[model samples]
Target chain A: TQLLEQSPQFLSIQEGENLTVYCNSSSVFSSLQWYRQEPGEGPVLLVTVVTGGEVKKLKRLTFQFGDARKDSSLHITAAQTGDTGLYLCAGAKNTDKLIFGTGTRLQVFP
Target chain B: DAGITQSPRHKVTETGTPVTLRCHQTENHRYMYWYRQDPGHGLRLIHYSYGVKDTDKGEVSDGYSVSRSKTEDFLLTLESATSSQTSVYFCAISDMGQGKAYGYTFGSGTRLTVV
Candidate 1:
C-alpha cells in the first residue's frame, strides 16, 4: 500500500503570515492533487500537479510536485482567516484511486 | 461544486444493524467513488464504480459492499455496523477516467455513527 505523510499536522498562524505544508512519500505517483476542506463539508480540489518539479498557483495558494513525484508541497501567501481549513494531499499511481496523506490543519487568526 | 449528493447527511445506528448510504450525481460522470475520512486519516477509498453495474473494491473495502445499478447512483452498504466503522463518508465523481489529468469533485459528505 502507498502512503503519504504530511508534516506539521497542526498549524496556527496570524493573518498575513506565510506557511508551507509538505507531503512526502516513499512511493512515486503519476499525479498529485491538493484539496482544502472546510468544516462540515467535503474536500474541494485546490490544484493538480502531474509533472515533476511542476508548480501551479491558485490565487493565494501555490502547489508544487517534487522532482521525483514522491513528494509535494502547498504554500499559502498572506494567509487569511478564510484559509483556515484542513489541507490534504493525494497521490495517484496509474489507477483512479487516490492515496491520501494524513492532512494538515491550518488556522489563520486575525 | 459537482452535482454530487449524499443522502442521510447524518445517521446513527447500533451494532449488528445494516446501513446503506446513497450517492447520487447529476453530471452523468462515468466514475463514482466512496471514501471515509477520520481525524488523522485524510480520506480512504472504500469502493468505486466505473459504469452502471460495474464496481470494484478499494483500499478499505472490508465489511463494505457497493452496488451501482444506474449511472447516477452508487450505494454503499455496511452489513453490520461496528463502532470502528463510524466516520464521515464522502462521494466523489470524475468525468475523466481514473488516473486521468483531471481531479475529482466531492459531495458534501455523510456522517455515520455506530454505537
Candidate 2:
C-alpha cells in the first residue's frame, strides 16, 4: 500500500503567525487532495491539485503539489484560532482508493 | 454539504455485538466510501461501492463489511465489535468519475465506541 507521511505531527503557533505543513510519499499519484477536519466532524476538502506543480489558493491558505506528484504542501498565513484543526493530505493513484497521510494537528492560539 | 447524513452520530456498544452504520445521500452519486478515523492513523478506507450491489474492499477491510442495495444508501456492518473498532467513521459520496474533479462530499461522521 502507498503511504503518505506528514511532517510535524503536531504544531502549536500563536495567532497571526505563518505555518507550513508538508506531505510526502514515495509513490507517484494521479492527484492529491488536502482536507481540514475539526473535532467531531469529517474532513472537508480544501483543495484538489490534479496536475504536477499545481498551485491553488483559498483566502489565507495556499496549496502546492510537487513536480513529481509525490508531495504536497499547505501554507497558512496570518493564522487565527479558527485554523486549529487536523489537516490531512491524501494521494490518489490510478485506482479508486486514496492513501491518506498521517495528518498534522495545528493549534493556533489567540 | 451534499445532503449526506449518517445515522446514529454516536454509539456505544458492548463487545461481541453487531453494529451497523448507515449512510444516506440525496445527491444520487454513484460512488460511496466508508472510512475510519483515528489519531496517528488519519483516515483509512474500509470499503467503497461504485454502484448498487457493487462493492470493493479497501486497505483496512479485514473485519468490516459493506452493502449497497440502493443508489443512495450504503451500510457498514461489524459482525463482532472489538475495542480496536472504536473510532469515528465517515461516509463520503462522489459522482461517477475518477473522483479528482468533482471531489467527494463527506458526512458529519459517526463516533463508535466498543467497550
Evaluated at residue B13, the lDDT of candidate 2 is 99
Pairs that collide, model 2:
none
Q: What is the DockQ of each candidate?
A: 0.74, 0.65
Candidate 2 per-residue lDDT, tens place, A1-110, comes to 43899998999999999999999999888999998998888888899998999999999999999999999999999999999999999887867767789999999999
lDDT of 1 by residue, B1-115 (tens): 5599999999999999999999999999999999999887678899999999999998899999999999999999999999999999999998876554778899999999999
Residue-wise C-alpha lDDT for candidate 2, range B5-54, written one tens digit per residue:
99889999999999999999999899999999887778889999999999
Best-fitting candidate, scored by lDDT: 1
TM-score of the candidate numbered 2? 0.96
Model 2 CA deviation exceeding 4 Å by range: none
Model 1, A42-73: lDDT tens digits are 89888999999999999999999999999999
Cα-based lDDT for every prediction? 0.92, 0.91
